[model samples]
Target: MKSQMLPTIFIMTLALSVCGVYSGKVLVFPIDGSHWINMNILIKELYSRGHTVTVFRSSGSWYIKESSPHYNSITVEDVAGGFDEDFLKMLISRIIQIQADGKSSWKRLQVEWELMKLGPVMTQMEINVLAKLLDDHKLMQSLRDAKYDLVLADPVGASGGIIAHYLNLPLVFNVRWTVHSEGHFAIAPSPMSYVPMPMFELADKMSFLERVSNVFFFAFYEFQAQFLIRPLWATFTNKYFGPDVDYFQLIQGADIWLMRVDFVFEFPRPTMPNVVYMGGFQCKPAKPLPQDLEDFVQSSGEHGVVIMSLGTLVSELPRRVVEEMAAAFAQLPQKVIMRYTGEKPSTLGNNTLLVEWLPQNDLLGHSKTRAFVAHGGTNGVQEAIYHGVPILGVPLMFDQPDNLSRMRAKGAAKVMDIFSVNRDTFLQALQEVLHEPFYRENMQRLSRLHRDQPMQPLDRALFWIEFVMRNKGAAHLRTESYKMPWYSYHSVDVILFLLAVLATFMASFVFGIKFLCTKVCCKHKSKLE
Candidate 1:
């Protein structure tokens, strides 16, 4: 049976590849976030093939000008300058900091920020971005005229979905699995029983207490988004999507959610067919390391080198953190290449090299690189996995802990809490991953699985993208469970029905017992008489 399946699958794949250029006009509307890195890969591949790809992005977004006949871009003037990229980073930082402080005043402030300031400001930002896309009447008409096959929607925000629906285009989502929100969960199967919410960073198998907390985690998430955030955003959303449309409903519009995750790392969870796993699609062939970096690693002798980075979102860390990190590296025999964006630390050891930015993937791919010590971001973690480098994860906030947890679970990494980090603990973590053989072996095993796929991640992504195009967004693959209400999804009605029947049977049995007792007592009285 397995042998037959392989031959048949190969035949079908061949058919898909040679299906005679069912080329498409794909509209790419990637959100201006960490998502852009992968989208850049997707765009390039689509154009490299025969497909006509057009992107609605800002002026300064990473793209070559008129790169090819098939490649094109449309820059929205207002979107280019309107949204403040730093504002979001600052807001998230402030929120996380306040949550850490846990003062009554801070709690009140967080509430006010979320209820009054955060929602309104974020809503206006989305409004500005989308309005700019639609504001030009002529541009809107031209987009209508182009007859796009599908809209590649970023699953993070509502603007992309709104635009796609307005244009009557089928929407396919490229999602990050670790997003773990009420809105994103709606895209596919996310049973509250086992699927750990990204916010909690709990393992797939939870303790009784953890499960209890997980339930509340979900409840609050759903409550906050549906009740608090939606009302505020809806005013702006309704203005654009028309008065009748529900803001929360926009997330459900995705015909497919191409999640950036693999089951090998994540815990086993139920997923529907349309929730396609296209994880590590961003793993590309590593370019050669710069000569200077190569020379630096070569100077490490037999100790090799370890790379450190906190990724873009949390590049500028606290001074103490940097000081401790430097102290930790100073103790290690291995040389370190630390990528930091803020002011360079003064505690520089001769073995430590600090750069504002580094080619992380290139460094990880290097043969002598011993370990990675950094903020546990999905991108960085995936890159490390691809390069077979073990990690010393310094998890800060959001999905970082969860990403780190997965790495730790895989036996390829160890997690040190950023909040509770000390020189002793930090240095030990670095040493353990560097010195251990199992860490390297486990990572190598994962790397083999990642690369050993029948087709590469990029090819698979392209195939699915074109498949969606060819199959009109592949609506047939969508699960009916998406359309189900919360009650129906969990089968509340079925439970109620069974409970009612059990109650009826119990009542009848009690009545029968009482009648038999009465008959026996009457017979006893007759015998006495």
Candidate 2:
């Protein structure tokens, strides 16, 4: 009997260990491309912790797969006019053409105008997809029946918040950009004075002219959000969620904001209680490179290896630009690993290896890596900071320039203008980053600071996510400021009311003084008579 009891106890213990004490169902709605990459990391972690995860992706999604061991997938069908690879490539090509035309201010304005046009197109496409998902009665019913503990979303697309509100589930945002602007601009007290607008490439410590441009860019984004993006989302939310529902307010009402930024990368700014900085959460210690790659890297000897990747979307550049880049790489003593899919440049050197894709993090982590040549995406910048590798940035478009600007301001990077960069300029920039001690020193300092946290960024993000699920919602951490009207939230109405009271008091005091003078004069006149 004692032996039988021991076996039963062993079985119970094993079961408990495999399936943890608590588990919650999570529903993830993520944007595709690089954003999905970030979200997928969290989903895997959630699965490892004994929780069930479901991911929502469109049928035409480029990066997201239908099946994964980490989580189940929910594929929405017939997402028309979606932002696909071909479409993105065309847009990128057009932008590159415009930039390559010349570096005149007019050319710059044309680029800005072109980006502004994209605002309406992207917003409309997102709303159309949201409508299709919400209108599907069967899908809606299935989601409602699932009884998810919380809804995690990237608020770049508005459906996540709207659907979460519809299901009456707790909402958590893994965010950097909301549809309106940067996540902080939507929820925090962002003063344009110090907080530089995104994409303008201005630093926190701005000169007078820089601040003017900052405010101008702020207004430009505000106009796009108010006049372009908001109307479409508002129309959709009115139809599905009701006329009373405001999508912007729904976004602001989220339980937690796992901000994809930290002070080490972003400028210091005012933030809220619910805003958790998980900058570099997706980064980890670099693993060993594959054998072939390792052999090549080891062959770099004293000079070490240099890596170049232009993020996910913009893989290839114009042939002329590609040739110039190749020529520049040919001159470097350092071994070059470039992720390119374009035609091989005639100037390509034996030292440079052009692969379709390389393990970016692993290469950066290698001790042989001396510097990185990259298109400054958020993920790449954070990874470089994590690995303590300096950068020579060739920013292509949209937030890439701004991302590089921050690194340059921090003394860890040197940025080049894609429009004007020829072989000579490109070669000069790379040599500076490679030879300079300060660039390496500065980036290593940032890496030290980033790694010296009590909890890893990923762990902190996971803890807050679990905390929200356990408590049903993190209402205690979230502020009720979103409910207030714009005037009330800014205290404009209160200021007006105080001004009215002051005016009334001053008028009454003046009247009292006039009345006293009249009475005294009348008494004196009567005495004289």
Candidate 3:
């Protein structure tokens, strides 16, 4: 009986070790503030589910340090030496130099500037440079030593995707906004369609000229892929890593793509098989607003409060714009709190207060805070929606225009061009949003829709992660479309049909001429006989 009991105990212990314990490690890379927030929530969820999580982020990111107690954090060093400062100086010097030069040189400079203005192309170039840095053999050896089972990367991180390819591990990509899906064959709508171009200016729509511009933009991307990106990536991978690392292979290695956008704010579109929409994962009804903030709102009397932020990256707006905004707020009946990183404006009025930073979620959730004036970043947009606050978006760059346009189309916000912005238009837009209850009602309706999903976004993300681990890769869920030719993917069969029709018409014309010539010769021969 003692021997039998010993055997039973051994079997139980082995089962517990094998089945209940997971040894897999997940490495996450978030490049910016928004990505940091999204990945932090995902890391916490992964940790609670009994997986070890590690994070890599940019050096200056605040959220990475804030999340140290929750997960292992590593900062990517700025290896380019004083590159950022030097780069800015060079840009300014070039501009001034070109201005002093003759018209031909200035025209050349303008052309170069236009090339830089193409956001997607510039982003791709930056991604290529980072990919080369990450492909260094030393870095690869270090990652290999870590023995991670999977790598989770933000698409914007650039290097992570390439590193995952080198390590031969399953990679999951996180896109924090809508425009990241451009050029990828996915069901998501191209948010770039909403961004107005200089050739075509309209609200909530793109014109024919805009469509033509997009075609040229797409062509430019392809050009970069063939000429710049492909060669650079190949050389880096071959020199430091191995010959097997290729651009197409890097894209194919991704097991899943996660987007941080809710379906409520976006229209239903065809989605790829492994693509998942997990937007608003970080949003929740946070703890009550601080007592002082609440008291301030309560003391504002019948007039409401306005929450204004330029987001993290663009925290310092031009001083003139700040003064104009302050002056505009002075006239409005609302109590305004502006989040500015630098010195406060000199003309700040009685109804307004300036702070370096405010707890954004807490302020947005306050009942007195009726509207948000924001830079149209995804994090800010999601928080505004979650708290049922309307927005007046002053888009800066990249996807902000598209994000703002989508909100306006939903009847939940208004968009103001930042360059042309002033006190009168700003005040009128603010009053319209606060005076009309429709904006608030629309936001609430969208919030309910977003919150009505079958599973909480974080839980859904966790389930997918576990599912991928258990299955040893989610490759079965991936689509064959990834293997299809570019023309086939975009459905160019109609063009082929038109070409075929043209060919048949030309053939029939040649055959008719031959037949007529033959008949004329035979008739002439009969007359001679």
Those runs of model 3 whose alpha carbons end farther than 4 Å from true positions after fitting are 1-23, 57-63, 74-77, 82-142, 176-207, 220-228, 238-245, 480-529
Between prediction 2 and prediction 3, the one with superior lDDT is: 2
* Every model's TM-score: 0.84, 0.95, 0.78
What candidate 2 gets wrong by more than 4 Å, as runs, is 1-20
Local error of candidate 2 at 465, Å?
Answer: 1.3
- Tens digit of per-residue lDDT, candidate 1, span 1-529: 9988999999999988878678799988776667777777788788878788887776544333424464577876555344446665776677556544333555644644553456545566666777777778899999999999989867666766777888888887777731126234776567667888774568888888998988887887667677656776678766776777765565675777777887766777777677777778887667888899889999999999989998776657666767777888888889999988877777668899999889998898888899998788888998998889998888766567778888787888888766556678888888788888989999999888887777776777778888888877777777656456778888898899889999999999999999999999999999999
lDDT of 3 by residue, 1-529 (tens): 9988998999999998878866568887665555566777887778876788888654544556735655787655544332233343344345434433223545544744544444344355455446545656686588789888788887653466666776777888776431223413333334456533211123435577766666565555556556655665577668756885565556655787787776675544456678777877778776687787777778788888998997765546566677778888899888998888766887688988787778898788777888999888888898888888999888755456667777887889988865456789888888888889999899988888888879988777777777777666788777656456668766698689888999999899899999999999999999999
Candidate 1: clashing pairs of residues: none
Q: Residue 313 error for model 3, in Å?
A: 2.2
Ten residues in sequence with the least summed lDDT for candidate 3: 195-204
**Candidate with maximal lDDT:** 2
Q: Write the number of the candidate with greater lDDT, choosing between 1 and 2.
A: 2
Candidates sorted on TM-score, descending: 2, 1, 3
TM-score for model 1? 0.84
Over 151-192, each residue of candidate 2 has an lDDT whose tens digit, in order, gives 999999887888899999999999999987789987898887
Count steric clashes of candidate 1. Answer: 0
